[model samples]
Target: MDLQAAEKRTKELHNLLNKYNYEYHVLDNPSVPDAEYDALLKELVDLEETFPALKTSDSPSQRVGGEILDMFQKVQHHSPMLSLGNAFNEADLRDFDRKVRQAIGDSFSYVCELKIDGLAVSLRYVDGLFELGATRGDGTTGEDITANLRTIRSIPLRLNEQVSIEVRGEAFMPKKSFEALNKAKDENGEEPFANPRNAAAGSLRQLDPRIAASRNLDIFLYAIGDPGETGVRSHSQGLDLLDDLGFKTNKERQRCASIEDVLQYVEGWQEKRPHLPYEIDGIVIKVDSLEQQDELGTTAKSPRWAIAYKFPAEEVVTKLLNIELSVGRTGVLTPTALLEPVKVAGTTVKRASLHNEDLIREKDIKIGDSVVVKKAGDIIPEVVNVLVERRTGEEVDFLMPTHCPECESELVRIEGEVALRCINPKCPAQIREGLIHFVSRNAMNIDGLGERVVSQLFQEKLIEDVADLYKLTYEQLISLERMGEKSVANLLNAINASKSNSLERLLFGLGIRHVGSKAAKTIAMEFGNMDKLANATREDLTAINEIGDKMADSIVAFFEQEEAAELIQELKDSGVNMEYTGARPVAAEESDSVFAGKTIVLTGKLEQLSRNEAKEQIELLGGKITGSVSKKTDIVIAGEDAGSKLTKAEQLGIEIWDEEKLLEELKG
Candidate 1:
């Protein structure tokens, strides 16, 4: 076909596909069947491949994703993405209403929206064409994630009208999408995300846009960045304008004329929340009038005109059937409460971590007692407290086992520690747990080596240690239950691939005491090889920043063990790469940069750079970024609305630099 015909057909296809996508994803109504949409999409792809120039940024084909990005660039939001103050109960909501009435004389209404449990993002459009999308990193500055955001089908690539605008929204993974993603992860022996919010955030932050596309993300545009530009008089109108412009807005939002009406709406939703496909942690109440919002104004961190009424954690009473003890990779005996199955926070709870014996004693928890259970942060199930009033005389006091349940070794509490630990090196439970840890996502990252498969391997005596994993043959694996020819091949390939991982993976997989993933990377980067790290003295280990005396002692102790040496030899004999392969950190003394040898702490919102960008630049110049304010901190880079960290630094007489000053120094 000619260029003109191709361009015309491409535009037609874009309109059709976008219309179908809007119906299917945003409106939850598809005009065409999946097969029809797929065929049309295929045709569009073919046309784009044949006539590349016809493919524009707004083309429906862009939703499939683009080239992988090395890193996300920093973006400055037009206006700060201010957070909202939270109202935990009805009293707090009334207090907020009182404050609003005092400012606006009770003349304003409120727009109540479901507080979507997802990542907050900013979308920008120039002349009604999608331009850029960013994260709400520190409010003032954010990371440019346009490529990833384009993959969400609900997000319109082009507006209905030719107008420049910016909007704020929640980018979310629906409950169904999150379930499917977790299911896939579980099948691949990967750790599933704790919640939909985490899954959405992880998906959007992926370096490859294709990964985000595969996550089945959705969005709800809530507010206009500059409502005045669109001539929208109220927040409710802004949402309507977003809908008119072909943007997805939450239809459940209501403009309440009175706080009583708002309270009723909030109450109604609390009961209906779980039935929805998406998660909402709270209800956001915003004064409807733009003028009233401006009058009420904002504080340093959050808008005073708006408040989020968080749902109280749903608590349920369940009988604690028994307490089960399990040994961890570190040999600590952790007690878990086995409870009668009860639903809390949208999921069923069968067991909750008791943490240690101390917690059990402190809570006065006993077997067969009625316990109040709740999900902490709406994710982890925990026994909030014992329902003493509901408990019967039949309740029995639980006792801590004197010996390890799996190994029968005597349990001893380490000095300065609360939990009882089994110190036996040859404990089967510890060995099994260690093997599982060794092949975890952050460790060796063996794809097909899940807990079940590892247990089977251990039980069969085909693999006793992490090193034995590399020695597995296809024939042996194929004989195991659920291990077909393809599955065995994939497992063997995954095992072989893990052998070539950098020294950090190997070091972390080893389960050395006090050496976490970050510490392992630092140690590996410093020594460059396993043999050098094995030979390093306590003092040698301690010389590195972030490696304290305790960690150094632990490292020295770990390497000095005869079994550790033997394990290393076995791994080496299995053709495992022992050298660090990641980028090396620059030596502090090597550069004359101002940041060299300085320990810096970043606080609050940076206007010019994303937190990561600033951190990368600082580290590149040999400065270390620590999380807290301390006497050890050489400098504090204070950004807008700097908080407790800045005050602490000031009290400590630590040198402080504003974002401007920091930027000046960086430029120099």
Candidate 2:
């Protein structure tokens, strides 16, 4: 066909296919048969191949798959995809309702939605055309997965209306699709996925879009990034608007006029959950009114206007075959209960954490005993209790080991701690576990050095400590099991790249007794460099905010170790960066800006800057941005539709500034 003819035909084909897809996937009704639709799709594909220019992004042919991506690029979310606080029982739901009523009065209602057991994703559309899709990574930033998301047939390539909008959704793999995929994997002698949620997450994160397309994933767009822009007053109305825009939203959502109604809906769904095609872990309850939500305000982590009511975890009885003990990076030995393989909460439970020796004694847990196991929040398997009545006399009592399993060093129970710990700094298990932690995602974040590779390297005796990681050669790595030439090259590059990371990464990787990731970052920023931190006394560390006495003591003790000093020198010799490289917090006393030394709270939506951007800019100017308004607040930045926070500020007689004023001050 001619180019002009192909273009016209392509436009017609796009409309027909989109319509048919919506009818089949979204509406559960198909006007045309599979064969007829396939014929037309084939014709369009041939035309697109003939005239490549005719194959627009919005065309149905794009849904088949796209070119492979080397890596996923990070994209900053337009608005923070805040998580919801959870309600596990009826009382929790009631408490949530009471809190909402107390803030916004009793007249308000709620919109209850099924919390799909899947990954949370954000989709951005520009002028009705699908532009971007991203995973909810740390709320503020996400990985760009537009190619993978485009393959989900239920997600419209183009909205019915020509408007720019960003929506949030749950991307899920249906139960049948997950089963089929696992069946195929098992047939091919590959490890099968544990559950639908994991399968969906894995599928969406695939580097090749064709793999995601084959998984037959679906989505339910539940929320808009900014509802004010859409002029929706209520959450339910926004969902309706999403449906009108040709987005697939779960039809099972209910508008609850009271908490009683919400409870009834939750209870009803619990009984009928197993009958559904998709997996739902819980029900999400959100305050219906947008204005009311703004009035209610939010915490640092979650919105006060919404809460997720998680379903009760499924429980099953399984035989405890044995107890296994392993040492952690911190040298604490933990016991795990090996169980007879039994399905619990949709996954096979092979083992459960025994926690500590004290817990085992308290529960009187014995090997070969029938134990009741349940997944905590449907994610982590735990032994709920021992079914003592079913336990045979043949069941054996388990005992804790006095020596370290790997190093054979005598174990000691630290004062006030229940778990037995090996104090030996050179314990092989501790060293191995510490190496794994050092290369973990939140630590040095070396991509190619996973748990398996780390274990292999440790077993091969090619590495002894974290400092030795920098000394690894390509030859040493390539000789390891499953390590190819390309893999070794990548692994070496990743290891070398980790050296350039800011001091916080290294600090967290060091396995300090009480220092977590946040505390590590705080300490790193306060000290400026590793040398200063190493030299710092407990008094110096304790003076910093959030660094408690225990953490300070731990920090001082860690730096004082002879082995630590030697490791530091070795790392220095290997050309590893030891200085903090991120933005330094400006001391209030030293800053000249008006925002300096001020605790500021931002309320409502800003037209000029995103919440993160405003917070970052203010923080750079020595302003501490808090989530809630209080009497201590020096200033409140009130934007469009400023609610309870603004009211509180007014009542408290605190200074308030508009977005324009804040922008002007920031510029100065």
Candidate 3:
């Protein structure tokens, strides 16, 4: 067929397939048979293959899959993805209602939505075409997963109207899909995912879009990124707008006129949660009016206008068979309770974390005791308490092991820490855990190299350290059990790609004591590279604002170790990138701006800049932006509809600036 004919045919097929997909997935009504849809899709695919240039990003055929990505890029959210404060009971719900009423008066209603037990994501559309999709990483910044999100058929490639907007949603796996996936995994002798939420998150994080496409994942858009831009006056209207734009939204949502109505909805859903095809951990209640929401504003981490009412965790009684101990990568010993097989929250519970010796003693948990087991967040099975009254003198108190379970070294408790530590640098368990951390998603992020793979490599003596991973041969990997040619190739590709990661990832993966991901990023930016960081003294490190004395000491002590020095050299020889490639914060000494050396707190609805944008600019001018107002805060930037922070700043006698003043200062 000619190019013009192929293009025409592809366009027609796209329109047809999009309509059919919407009917089946969104509307829950299939207008055509699966076979007919498949035929049309196949035709479009063929046409696209013939006329490659005619293939567009929004074409229905693109929903199937795309090329594998090397790494997910970081995306800055235009608006912060603030989490909701939780309400666990009717009283908590009433408290939330009271708070809302106190802030915005009793005239406001609420919109209650089922909080899907899945990963939170942000989707951005440009001129009605889906442009970007991202994981909610740190609320402000997230990982770009546009390719993987495109595979979900329910997500519209192009909206009905040409509008640029950003929306928040939960990406999930249906119960049927999760069951089928677990069944297949079980049949293949592979470990199944703990729950549908985890399965969905894992599937969406796949570097290969094809993997995500095959998972049968779905999304329910809940909120708009900016309601004012959409001209939506309330939360319910925002959801309606999403639906009108051909986006999938949960039909279970309802507008509650009062707290009693909200309570009724919550109770009804809690009882019916088990019968649903998807998982919901809680109900999200939000003040319906956008103007009221603005008035209520937000805290540092959560929105004041919204609250999540979590369902009571399902609990079951089980016999405590025994307790097992294990050493983690940090040399900290942890205890696990071995329970008699019992079902809890739809999963069989045989084990639960005991946390530490102190917790075990505090709870007075004894072996062979009847205990209440409940899944925390409907994911992890945990022992709530022991039924000491039911004990028939058979239960024996569990003693904390004096020695390390793996290395047989004497365990010692640190000065300020609770967990018993082995303190053995060469401990096998610690080494194995370290290797796993090195390949973790937030670290080197080597795809196809999970904990199991890391364990296998450690057991085979093929890898001793993170550096050894770069030296792996195809022959050695291919000889390992379950390592097929394709799998080996993918692993090798992932390993090769990881060599290019920024210094912060390497710092976090190194497992430096007391240094978390955020601290690593801060230190990496401060020093710029591994060489400088290694040479940095405690004083040098402590000079940086975020690095505390403990962190500084830890970093200095780590770099002073001969083994640590050798490891850095080995990693450097393996061609790993050690430089901080990301944008660094402006130095206070280098800036003459008015915001220099000032600790600024921002609050309320900014008409000019989003919270993040304002914060970034403030920091760039050498100002430190904190979340809350305190005696230490030098300036509080109050925008239109300023809330509690503004009031608090005024009460504290802290200097406050409006948006115009902030803008003027920024200009100067």
Candidate 4:
């Protein structure tokens, strides 16, 4: 076809595919068959490839992913993403309604929306085209995840209205997607994500947008970034505007005329929540009128105009049949309660993490005793308390193990930690756990080599260490039970791919006592390579900001070990890249921006930048980012809903910058 013909065809195809995507993903009504969509998308892809210059950022083909980003840049939100105060019971709801009525008079209604248990994000559009997308990082500054956000088909690449606006939404994974992901993870021998919310977050955080596209993430836009920009007076009207602009807003939202209606809505959802495709922790109740919301105003951390009515945790009484102990990669002995199967939060409760012996003793948990079990954070099953009053005399006090359950190594407590540890480096359990951690998603990310495969390899004596993973022959792998030629090939390919991972991944995968992923990344960037990191002194290591004595000591000790030295050499021989290849942070020495050489803490909901965005900008200006306020803080940037951090800054007499001031400074 001619260039002009191709251009016209590409535009037509883009429009057709986008409409189909909106119909299937946003409206849940597909007018076109899967084949039809695929055929058109294929044509668009071919055309874009033929005329690469014709490709635009908002093109349908971009949804498949464009480039692998070295790191996510920060994107400031146009408005602050404020969190809402929570109401736990009927009284709290009633009080909230009463307060709203008192402030705005009797002439107001409310919009109740399902508070989806997912990551909050902001979407910005310019001239009806999707421009930037970000996370609700600290409500002010957020990471630029536009590439990943584009993969979410429900989020329109171009709005129906040609208006510049920003919208807030909950990006979520449906129950089916969550289940499918977990099932895939389990099949691949990887650890399953605890909840859909976490799964969604993890997927979006991937540096490679293609990974996020594979996760089936969706969004439900609820509020406009600036309601006045859209000329919407009420929350319900704003939602309508969102829907009309080709955005997917939650249809479950309802207009509550009274507190009784709000309560009824909350109560109705509580029982039906489990049946929904996506998880929701609570219902968000907002004062309907924008005028009323302005009058009601906001508190230090949340909006007084809106409150989240959180669902009470579902708890159940179950019998503690036995106590089991397990050894971790760090040799920490973890105790678990083996409980009689009971239902809690729609899942069967068979076991719960005891955390440590102290928690077990504090709860006075005994075998054969009735105990209250609940899912903490609606994810981790935990023993809430022992039903001491109902405990039978037959119940026996549980005893803590004096040795590692797997290797019988003496358990010793570390100087500052509560859990008992096994100092024996040769413990089989620790070796197996270390191997599992090495191949985990955040580490080397060796797919097809999951915990099950690692365990099998360990038990069969095919692999003893992570370095041994590279030594496995195809014949050896093919001989294992259930290992077909195709499976073995995939495993080998994944193992080969992991060898190219950057230095930080290797450092984290080593399972160093105190060196987490963040610290590893910091150290990796500072040193540039394994050889330099290995040769660094404890004092030299500790000199880096955020690197404390414990972490420095751990790094020094890890490098000092003869075995670690041998392992490093072995990994090198196996062709593993040991240099830091990821994006490096802007150092104070390299920047001369106003924020240079200053410690900054961001608190409250920022109207313009998400917390991460502000932090990135501050860092770009050579400022250091710290989580909390202290005497060390040079400046505190307070946004809307500034909380304790702001108060602490005032107490410390630290310089405070409001959103307007910070933005002005940034502009200057």
Candidate 5:
């Protein structure tokens, strides 16, 4: 094909695919089947391959994300992505109403819109074309995710208005997309995302935008960041402007003249939320007048001018037929309230988290009590209230055992800790839980291993600890009940593959207290390997910023055990990524380490490394990359706006750099 013809064909294919993506994801109205969409996408890929030079980086093919990034690059937001104040109950909502009334004197109306259950993102348009998009990191700064954001068809790459403006929106993975993604992950021996929010967040963070594109994310524009040049008088007007600008604003938005109308709107959605395509966490009620919003201002965490009236967690009553305590990988005692099966938020709730002993006492919960249960954030189910009035005298007051219910070990509640823990490293329950976690998708991510399979392995004496999982034979696995030959082969393949997961994943799967994924990643990058990390003192750990004292103590305690030592040796022998070969000196020791003390600000989109890769590069150079642009920044890898940081860097005379310059330095 000729150059012009190919270019036109590319545009045509992109538009067609984007339209189908919108219908399936944004509109929940799929005109073409998934198979048809995939076929068109395949054709687009073939065409792009044939005319590789004609393909733009923002083309839909770039979404799936690139190689696993070692760290995330930091970008300062052009505008502060402020959070909204929350109202948990009716009284809280009334108080917010009173505050708004006090400020505007009941004359100003409010715009009530659904508070979407998704990550907040800010998009910048320069001369009516999408230039950048980012997360709501630290409010003042975020990661530049323009490449990923452009993949969302609902988000127009080029606006009709020739204006520079920033728009705030919620980036969410549609329920159907989430389900499909999770299903695929499950089949691929990967860990499934817990919810749509997690799925969306993870997908967008991928270095390759193609991964994000494949996830079928959609968004709803809510607020206009730069009202400059646009003569908008009210929040409602701002919504109109966004809609006119070809942004997908929520249809549930309403203009309520009084607080009563606002309350009615919130009440109506309490039941109507489930009918929507995406998840709505609550209702955001904002003072409509732009002038009034300025007067009301904000608190440190959220804006006072707007308040989110959160719906009470959707609740349904179920009988607490049994109270079961299970030991976690970290040896914490978790009580599960096995309930009489009931439906909540489209899923059947057979069990709910009983929290800890304090929760049981506070709720005055007992065996035989009918309890109210609901899914928090349409995810984990938990008991909300106990039906004390419905309790017959025959109902027994449940006493949470002071011992490890599984291994009879004495339980101890550490100060400032809510959980009653079984500190015995060798406790059977703890070992079982640890094994489960180790093989879990998020951690080692071994495939074909569910709780049932793990239990069967243990019962049949084929496995004991997590290490035993790797030693299992296909023959032994096939012998287990219902383990078909194909299933066993797939399971074995997954177990074999998990021997080399990155150090961060292995650390988090270990289930150390106060050590979440972010913490684990930080530690993995800092120590570079398990051996050094295991040997580090509390002071050494505390020196790294973001690692708190509690976490340091937990690390100290975890590594002190003989079992931890044994596990480490076993994992090393099993060929896990046991050392820090990847997280150091970006230029193979050729460049001086002066970049160590100098932080760089990443702005705009880079075709090279992802935000995560950029952050890792800076860190490896013995330097730090902070999310915000500050006087301390040595250089700003200015991409697009670079926002306030670019302005601040200019003001501070900090060395400014771009993605190409940084890449060139790395190559050196």
Candidate 6:
């Protein structure tokens, strides 16, 4: 298409996408299939690539996210996004009601709704289009996550009305989506998200919008940031406006005429919550009238206008039948409790993490012991306490293995840590673990290769070390049990693709002691090359910010070993990136002024720059991009219907800039 035609088409695509995004995210009514939406997006990408000048910040393609920012920008809200006081039970609710009645001395009504178990956010709109999004940071400032917010299809890109407004709500993962995400994580050999809250928070905070998009996030607008400004007189009126403006709001809201009715609503949900598709931690009871809300006002941290009536924690009892052990990719032995099947938090509890030998001994737990199990943080099954009085004589103490359970190598407890590891680098279990770690999602992120497949590969001796992964053949893979030709080909393709991974990934995959993803990134950038890092003294290594005494010692020890040195050399020889360059930013020395000490949050899209480029620009300007919004934010760069973050920023009276304005700042 010609430039003019391309520009016109891009504009048309933007409008169409905006309507669909609003319909789906805010209205919960999808007008198109996901596949259809994806196809349109692909077309837009192609058009933009062919005619770069035709792109704009509002384009749907720009929502995939940008590079990591050195800092988060601070944004002050127009009004404080006050926290709600919590009511643990009916007594607390009655107390709140009594306090409200005493304060006003008039008959009052309330709106009772589900308190979604998710991260709180604020969204701001100008002229009916989303302009900014931010977190509820300290009820004052917040982080900007425009790009990440755009990836949430449930979030409207535009509003139904032109009035500038702020809405506060929750960003959440539905129960079904949470389960699917956790299952996918488990299958990918990654740690499952602990709960719906964590899952939502983690997904929203991802630097990559693609990662956030994959998690299936949803949101619900609860209240307007400035209800009086919107000409809405009550909490119920705000919900009506939110609904009319195509904003997604929870449907379980009720107008309560009395405190008794509010209590009834809360009690009803306590039993009905499990049947809902999304997680509801409690019930939020709000004074219905804006006049009442203002009269009620707030405390330093919470609103007298609102209260979260919380439910009792979910816990169940089960018997510990036996202790089981699993070998990690690093050959670290972890003990787990095999329990008699019992229901806890709506799921059957058959096992729980014992943490380690120390925990088992400290707790004095044994087989045949009755244990109280609760979903720790409402996600992972955990043994909270042992019912010592119920323990029978049949219970047996679990002994820590003297050797590696898988390879039978003598185990040694590493000093200053809980893990007992097999020092044998060449041990089959260790090798398999190393390979799995190398290909894990947080490491090289090799798709299609799972733990079971890696185990089969090891058992068949088709490969060794991470380097061997690049050398696999279809014939060898197809020979394994349950391996079809297509599966084998896909695995090989994923391995081949992984060869292009940057230096940070290689560093993480090496699995050095006292090293994590953050540490690996720092080390990779500091030394610039694997060989240089290997030769660097502990003092030299500790000079980096994330590097410390324990980490340096571990890194030095890892490099000092001949086997590790050989493995590094082998990986280098096999085409893994051993030098850092692809995405490292210049030192804090590089451009340090107007942007200095500034924290900015980027949300939605910037048509003129890649997400990475935007991040680098912000850092170069001496600004930091924080993962979440908080009181420390300086500015929020927003795009589209930015959701609760924008609401938060407005509530805090934070200044917001659009993509066009942000681009100008970066360019200047």
Name the candidate that leads on TM-score. 6
lDDT of 2 by residue, 1-668 (tens): 67777788888888899999887788654556555788788899899888887878888888978899999999999999999999999999999999888888889889999999999999999999999999999999999999999999999999999999999999999887886675444323244566798999999999999889888899999999999999989999999999999998986788899999999999978866775678999999999999999999899999999999999877999899999999877677888999999998677889897767877898899988999998753556888889889866999999898999989999987665566888898898989999999999989999988999999999999999988899999888877778999998898889889889999999999988767787898888888899999999888987676676767888888888898999999999998999999786576678899988888888877999988789988888888887556556889999987765787799899999999999999999
- Per-candidate alpha-carbon RMSD to the true structure: 22.5, 26.2, 24.9, 21.2, 19.8, 16.9
Q: Give the per-residue lDDT digits (tens) of candidate 4, residues 179-269.
A: 7776444323344576788999999999999899888899999999889877888889999899899999886778888889999989888
Clashing pairs in 3: none
| CA lDDT, candidate 5, residue 400 | 76
Better of 2 and 3 by TM-score: 3
Candidate 1, residue 40: Cα displacement in angstroms equals: 1.1
The estimated TM-scores of all candidates read: 0.54, 0.52, 0.53, 0.55, 0.49, 0.56
Stretch of 10 with least lDDT, candidate 6:
183-192
TM-score of 4: 0.55
lDDT, candidate 2, equals 0.87
> Which 10 successive residues of model 1 have the least lDDT summed?
183-192
Model 5 TM-score, all chains together: 0.49
Cα error, candidate 4, residue 603 (Å): 45
In Å, residue 67's CA in model 2 sits off its true spot by 1.5
lDDT of each: 0.88, 0.87, 0.87, 0.86, 0.77, 0.78
Score candidate 4 by lDDT. Answer: 0.86
Model 5, 506-531: lDDT tens digits are 89888776676777877888888898
The sequence of per-residue lDDT tens digits that candidate 6 reaches over residues 565-623 is 88777777778777776654434456555566676776655677766677778876767
**Over all chains combined, what TM-score does candidate 3 have?**
0.53
RMSD versus native structure for model 4: 21.2
